[model samples]
Target: MLIRKALIEDLNNIMNIIANAINDMESKGIYQWDNTYPNEKIFSNDIFKNNLYLYVDKNIIHGIIVLNEHQEDEYESLKWKYISGNHLIVHRLCVDPKYQGKGVAKDLMKFAEKYAKENNYESIRLDAFSQNERACKLYENFGYNKVGIVTFRKGDFYCFEKRLIKYGS
Candidate 1:
């Protein structure tokens, strides 16, 4: 699979991937997303700002990730282990439900880490739905520190941050 910055034409494909993810989560009793969140407009905005990225293989988008520097107000109150104004905040990380167990999520995360370090960013920050055990486990196993919890429209989410270092350190 190849990971690269998303193009305008990739919007619809990305939305389909997200929809599949939402359905997969709800089917598993994880209410992490609903109709209102991660809508087309939000994704359009992300695409406009060139913050969106996609994992594509042979012309199909298998995963999506958004990286921005803005953190929510709720994050300001959390005690993060690493404090940095220079960081890449990850949002709306989703893999096509059909391709999930094939290490697509892992590839996306590794891409995020490399993106941060290559761009001279200090770290990667993100939040996961408290009920998304698979996502929480992925983040934890990947060495992201869960520093606090924050509430969003769906429900509570655990905030995480991973400080960047030289590759292979």
Candidate 2:
């Protein structure tokens, strides 16, 4: 398995993965995403900015994650723990439903942490839908602390942060 930057050619596969994820979430009563968000346009922008990444194995795209510094405006109200330096914000983390339970999301998250450390980021921050138990548990299991909550169109999301490096250490 390898993680690499997403290209325009990968958009179709990425969209398919996202669609499957959306269907799976909705089927499970988790309305975290829909057609309105994470559309092709947003993903295209991520690709254009070199922020999107893909997890591929044997030429098959299994998952995707966006790592960047673009935090939502709602995050401003949250009292984040690590406020001293640059932060890597995780977004749009989705694995093809077919690849679910196969460690694809875990691998993607591992990649994000490594990327942040290599880039000298002070922390990693993300928001998981409060109702999405799988996502919230994943973040908590990975050592991320729930800093606060932010509400979006669907509902409230728990903001989490994992400090990667101490500023003075």
Q: Please give each candidate's TM-score.
A: 0.95, 0.97
| Regions of candidate 1 where Cα sits further than 4 Å from its true position | 167-169
TM-score, cand. 2: 0.97
Q: Find the candidate with the highest lDDT and give its number.
A: 2
lDDT of 1 by residue, 1-169 (tens): 6888888888888888888888988899998887789899999999999999998898888888899898999999898877754989999889999888999889999988988888888788999999999999999999999999999988899999999995656
Best by TM-score: 2
Q: Which ranges of candidate 2 are over 4 A from the true structure?
A: 166-169
- Could you give the C-alpha RMSD of every candidate to the true structure, in order shown? 1.5, 1.6
